[model samples]
Target: MVDEALRAARAVQSRLRDLPSRVVIYLILAACLFPEVGYPGVWRKLTGALVGLPVAAPTASALAQAR
Candidate 1:
């Protein structure tokens, strides 16, 4: 659904960036999932989840821009 929405929104990556649109999308969803956790808490959770993956965790400023 998020992919579809991204497409509909015409969100394209024109340049190489640290945080991909998909990652930002999931971060937004995560924020909703753990409303009480706050941004920092959500970021910690995101970093933990990404530990086993090849993706790099986004910086706090980058995440804030995504929002």
Candidate 2:
């Protein structure tokens, strides 16, 4: 649903060099899902899941700026 909403809003289409918008959106969703975890914790969890993927996790600073 979030993916669809982002797509509808054209939020996924961007020229940014770092941190794809979809990744940022998913990170936000993950943060919501694990409210007990702080931002760093959420990022660790997200990066864990992303480990097998071809993409690299965004830095903490990049995530903050993306938000």
Candidate 3:
């Protein structure tokens, strides 16, 4: 049905959450290029943190085993 197809499309769109991140980057670039728009401090910080995400460490035994 049309309704079911519509619902499926919406669900796929929702799962594509990366779109928001890309939009934020674009907005930040625009702000930087056009100083009149002002600085995108919040967006810059958010993107920076997202890019510099923390990595998980191996457990003590796991690390020793590799050594």
What's the residue-level lDDT of 4 in candidate 2? 89
Cα error, candidate 3, residue 62 (Å): 43
> Across residues 1-67, which tens digit of lDDT does each residue of candidate 1 receive?
8778878899956777777787778888899999998766787888885666776666667778877
Please write out the lDDT profile of model 2 over residues 1-67, one tens digit for every residue.
8778888887776576556777778778888999887666788887776666776656667777776
Give the backbone clash total of model 1. 0
Q: Against the unseen true structure, what C-alpha lDDT does each candidate score? A: 0.78, 0.75, 0.42
Query: Which of 2 and 3 is ahead in lDDT?
Result: 2
Instruction: Provide the clashing-pair count of each candidate structure.
Output: 0, 0, 0
- Residue 53 local lDDT, model 3: 73
Per-residue error at 67 for model 2, in Å?
A: 1.9
lDDT, candidate 1, residue 61?
75
Model 2 quality (TM-score):
0.63
Best model per TM-score: 1
Candidate 3 C-alpha error for residue 17, in Å: 6.4
lDDT of 3 by residue, 1-67 (tens): 5335546556323444423333434544555666553343433433465655753333334322322
